[model samples]
Target chain A: MSSATTFLLTTIMISFIINIAISLYGVFAKPSLVKKFIALTIFSDSVNSFAILIGFRRTPLGYPSIAVMPSPPQSVEDLKRFVSEAVDPVPQALVLTAVVIGLAVNMFLVGLIMLYYKYYGSTSTRRVKI
Target chain B: MSTLQDPLTGIAPLYLIAVAFLTAALGLVIRSNKFFKVFAIVNTAIVFAISAYIMHKVVDEGIQLYFFGGYPAPLGIAYEIDNLNALLGLLATSIMLLSGIYSAWYMNFPRTYLYYTLFLTLLAGSLGCLYTGDYFNFFVMLEVLSLSSYSLVAYFRDSPKSIEAAIRFAFTGIISSSFYLLSAFVAYASFGTLTMADIALKARDLNAVTQFSGGVVGNVAIASAMMIALASWTWTFKAAIFPNYFWLPDAVPEAPTPISAVFVGVIDLIGVYGAIRMFYTFFGQGSIALQFRSYTLEIFQILGAISVFIGVFLLLLQEDVKKFIAYSTISHLGLIFMALSLDSGEGISAAILHTISNSFAESLLFYSAGIAIVAVGRSINTLGVLRKYRVALAGIIIAMLNLIGVPPLLGFWSKYLIFKAFLDTGKIYGVVILVLATGISAIGYFKMLFSTLKPVEKIREDPRLRNSMLADITIALCVVILIAIGALYMLSPSARKFINEIGYNVIEGYKAYYAFLSSGS
Candidate 1:
């Protein structure tokens, strides 16, 4: 309901849109293999960031955005009390795994790219026609 | 005493794992040409022993959880061996051993230790991914598998297309891994657990924050988990799903037949295994349902149909014998998925049977292709590669026929089961599409065979190239074994029951086992 919560949510959604646009551009327009690879990597990272953002929550007090479970403390005052939970951890773990997988994939791509360059002396996607 | 109590409990399997590690180490240390032979044989044997032991543990004791240094599941890394993993582990080892022996004679160049080292490492990486319970450990193993495969795909660095294909394959692999990790993060955050069992159990209770109409809808917790669950489909690209299948046919052709055999034949099995484990065990009844909601099964069904159609269509067009077989592999996987998407007892059983048979038939295709190429001293495209070598061509033709689901062959029985499954479910459209795909694929297989029987041009055959009578016989022998298995499935209900039980264990999860246990009780 608060202004800051609204602002954070909007920011996350906009970034996700931008990520999709950039990835589409790279996949469709890029003439070079390396560029497409870079674009895909960026797109995946952006998506990962969006996943983390979705899990964010904000409290009435000055605390980090997080999720809150129901069932308040015993007293009425305790029930009204708010505390920030950390943002959802699931997306973050998924992102961590995705990033490492991305890196390994990048290393493999780089090796292939170098091999391609050695064989054809060009990184352009159109040049290496099978 | 704690770690080494029962014979089946821990000690033997651990020793076997050590032996597997030692084989990898030995492959690294030993540089002699002759040493590669020894290394390949010993390494494969050791891996087989380890897998067999693990498989025994899984069947007898349910999932086998091995915590290192006496640490338990929550605190330390766990190697979980359920039926799904146990099957894949056994599959990886057996195929690696079979194909490794077959490759010794098939590879044109001298047996360098590099080949064995890369081969064994690839085997280990795949097995590790199947067994490890922790998400992080699975990622690490996947990385090792991807790295090795990338190099193997580009091993014939002489061709630019090979490099290009590898690049594409690697990029796709990275994207898949990224999605996988993103999903993993989501699951971890949602449940605060990394252990597969715990995560599966905990993810179900996740309720979403109630929001306004325009805001985030549904349970936020479930949404996050679903996003994570769906991310894994990225790896389906690596698995050569319909649209993402471009690289497999091209990349697979560029590798040496043995490596190609491993890549197209065995590696995809690992992908299927990962998908099953993640979906069925970790996310099946838990977070996945919330995450996927209704679209998951529908999407899988659609993808399955497309892959089956596209793969068979492509297979029909393929002129290159190896490429034809590669396309067939994709088409077969599509059929497997179709059966899997059905999500029935019989349907799942059909998929598992198809997976096993296809692995063998595809490997046989690669092996025969290699032998014929060497014999004729050119690729399969050159005329008379098969006709000039009658015995060799016959062997490959039989394999190709087997591939096309001809009666009494391995492919026939599995394809039949899938048809029966669709019919049982009254999926008329699926049945029609499957029959059509099989009909079209038969043409592709025949073409490959046709090329083999054509007369040879007057190209000079190398005198020093020893005619591998043994290799030809081995190819024939594998075909026989495949046919025998297929025939066994036809005649015996017990074999069907055995396979069905394994499938039920895999696709239905603990529910199947619980039912069986209760009946016994």
Candidate 2:
């Protein structure tokens, strides 16, 4: 609710939306397959960032912490404090898996575009469209 | 652990996944075509038997949940076995088993080692998608299925058209699947758990199970709207309805014939299956999906109707037989979509039966066409060659009649149920949609089917076509299957009761479905 925090949050939110928009347009409109591939990477990365953001939560002390426990909780009070202070770990794990999948798909597509290039001598959809 | 999840029998789904890896490894180690053919066929038959055995267990014992890695529902992945998915599992394995035998001659082995590798992986991915209880897990399994299918669609790497279709298919597929991933994230963000049953429970009533989530979340209705909207885009694309229908015409013609059968028969049905699960089971009545969009289900009907119209008109113009079959797929899927959105148990069962029957008829047509195409070349104009092959001729006639929904066939009963379900729901326009769809589409069906009676301009022979005992047997098997299921419907009271029961469970079996989900924890 503080002025500085509000300013920071608004800026981050606006930029995230802008990034997603730019990446989407790139994927949809690019004439070159490789360019579209780049856009796809950014698009997936933006979604991954959103997934990571889903886990973000502020502690009672008004600071964000990673999903890891600060240390092994030795007491009930310690466990409760750790739970309240840390962000949710599940989305982070989900994002990790998504990242790996994105990499595999990207590599396969790049290889595919290369194959298409060999067959048609270009990666431009304009020239080699079905 | 639940007793139902206690046996080696519980690993029926896992066996397919492991076998897929085994097949992939075997391809690298062995170079013998005959060995791979027998091995693949034998493996598929065994899985088919296991699915049938476990399907009976599910029906008699109630819903079964098998936990992977022993980590209970919320923490680890789980597979939920129910009558609906059990039927799909049976469908998936049986179709793949039959396709294997058909492919024994269709695929040139040693050279097609990679094809079978991808084939088994596609099967595992489908089994995974059907059985997994986690929403995120569904996303992973869908990706597995899509990746293998993208490769298979471009199996003829020498052709630029095939590669281009594969590229477009891959790009569209990745983007659409990511949307599903986003839905899963939204669900996890809102429901505070990734387990599908937990999410369903939360969607219906958040306070019903307050144990897992003390986390912050969004409004259920708004969240459900976002999730359903995003997720259905993927389903529509997968089902090849409307705007997504663009890929099918291009992709189906380019792939080898058996892969074409896999596309129409096994792969497309999974899309309808996903939609049914998301709409009816995951977010059913009294959930935010109902309240958030006044016409969420109506959207299905409207899209279905347009897709049917578009598919039919296009089918009339397609010169390529494979592309014609692809358009027919769009029309059939649209009809299923309309049924799924209807207001009664009749709607759900009607959709399920149609999905089953439609896949059979469509695949049989493709298989029969394969025999002719390999001999005379791939064109509906060349279908005259089928006259010499009685099995292919019989296959085409029966499948076309069944697809056209001519009475006394298996396809007709499902179409009739869909009509009845529409009336039961008091949607008169549904009747208009059904009648006009069948009436108009039948012309295209006959135009193509009747081509077999016309004489060919010239004939070319492939020796394999003369020796296609395996394909002849496969076509006969398909023909027998279409007739048997149709006969059983009219003669057996149990058959009527069973299909009706599966339909009822689809619409109203949530309590039993709920218990299995929660039991995993």
Candidate 3:
């Protein structure tokens, strides 16, 4: 890997980690339910992005290709090379599923929070009694 | 029984998934809650039958594998059935079946079709958690299970307490599950695969490749440690251990009693199973994660011991009957985790056995607590109302004794095994923790038992409470199963041997676990 490319990648990865940390702090330290929900959204999407980073790969052509077969390979060597060049589909599929689930859970929690507000007229964490 | 049934292991979970959606669709078309309840009961019965068949097939054969889309391991989703998960399948199905039957009489509110739909979906998600052979599948199912549980917790949407409990449960649940998902990412990034058995094989033999990709590509030790740290937090929360246990006591007491019973017995168990899968199966005997695993397990042991003391102390101070039972459950789960952290064959087996008996015992208490407190309200002082209902009184006694670890009862042997495992591991403090937790929780148990003996006349005039034959039958059945299984454990050698083998095979049977995928590297 070239030094410039390595430096750019390292900086991007560090920022991803920082984003995750900040979102988690928001989730825990924020007092309002809506703000906490927003934080949760960022947290999950950040992790989903992290997953894409895991499965992402580059091709010899300087740009990466997905796991899909662009064209049929004729020889065994061709198929083997195709496998090596393509990005892993598993993590992509995983990220998609995680994002969908995160959406559903976020919707559910928000709905619950709305109901909670109707009962107490506030989304602040202080109003919820044990 | 026949060659045609070879693929039933794969078909069983799919059947459960199909039935979950079918139950949802049935609720929409059929507006009658009675019809919905009966449909759910029948569906649970059939699911139980399928699980029994899978259990039989698994015992006759060894591990069974079914690849989705006929794609080989590591490239497609897989369902691997070994002795451990197959046994859990039977346990989960049976618990839900009993729950289905009991809930028929218990749930009287309108829009109860929604409740039944969520119930079946919870069962489906729990079964998926138990039966799945892939990491991503497990994460998705955990979400399914958590979402349903959160909804069910706040099923009484009008009540502020239910909403409060649901919020606490949901926030912790979502965050914990996301952490688990992150661990899965770390795993896939380093291992180049997400299939569990493939990961297991490669974790032990670093150079081993799956059918689709080469394995252990980068920084295996750090990745494994990260996965363990992330996954254990989720597992501990799901299982309701210390520091992560805030939601359980609140959630259970607010939800309807049958849902409370199922939550304690079935839903929380997914975490224990996940921990075993990671520590014993995936991160098993070799790989470079050994030092990190041992260090983390020690931390887990300390956490488990702390939870035991914490649970018992809080349990004694509880004023509500249902919350008392939930606290008792937390302590039992603490015992299970302590056993799990011991990381020996006997420890795992004891953990598994304790889980079964604890589920039955806890559910038995919650089922009987229904007649004891619901009509009168949640106060523990009203347990004297239970005195008039002879069956509930007996159920409470047996259940309490079972939890308190009376000799020859169902809970005793599992507790005995946990203690023995602790002693064998030279962790004398674990035994001290066990004995102290049991002794302290006993005070709470006896308080409940004695309160029932008092002369409270509030429930004697309630006619609606006297006519619940189905609920009584469920309670009686739990008592009988508890005594029967305990007796069978005492008298039958094969039953004892079978449980021992499951505990033993969980860690040692890795070779056979992956042997089904002969074509995979």
Candidate maximizing lDDT: 3
Real contacts recovered, all predictions: 0.55, 0.59, 0.90
Q: lDDT (0-100) at residue A42 of candidate 2?
A: 88
Runs with alpha carbons beyond 4 Å of true place in candidate 2? A1-10, A66-72, A128-130, B7-10, B210-216, B516-521
| Number of the top-ranking candidate, with DockQ as the measure | 3
Off by over 4 Å in 3: A61-70, A74-81, B1-5, B460-464, B519-521
Candidate 3, residues B1-521, lDDT tens digits: the string is 12333566677556766776776777677778788888889988988998898888788887767777677767878888888898888988988988888898788788887888788889888988999999888998899899999999999998988998899889889999999999999989998888898888878888775567666777888888899999999999999999898888989998988999998999779989999999888877765788999998899898888888888999999999888989998999999999998979999989999999999999999998888765687889888888778898999999999998898997999999999999998999988888889899999999999998877765544554857888888998889989999999999999889888987898677678776555532
Candidate 1: list runs displaced more than 4 Å: A1-17, A20-24, A40-105, B1-31, B108-111, B203-221, B282-294, B377-383, B387-391, B458-464, B467-470, B473-477, B506-521
Q: TM-scores for all candidates?
A: 0.82, 0.96, 0.96
Going through the candidates in the order shown, the clash numbers are: 23, 0, 0
* Best-to-worst lDDT order: 3, 2, 1
Better of 2 and 3 by DockQ: 3
DockQ for all candidate structures vs. native: 0.36, 0.67, 0.75
Give per-residue CA lDDT, model 1, range B89-171, as digits (tens).
Answer: 77677777777777666654543555665676788678777777776667667766777787787776777767777776776
What is the per-residue lDDT of model 1 for residues A22-93, given as tens digits with 9 covering 90 to 100? 885885478787788788878777867776775665655544644444565566555444333545454565
Candidates in order have lDDT scores of: 0.67, 0.83, 0.85
As for model 1, its CA RMSD to the true structure in angstroms is: 6.2
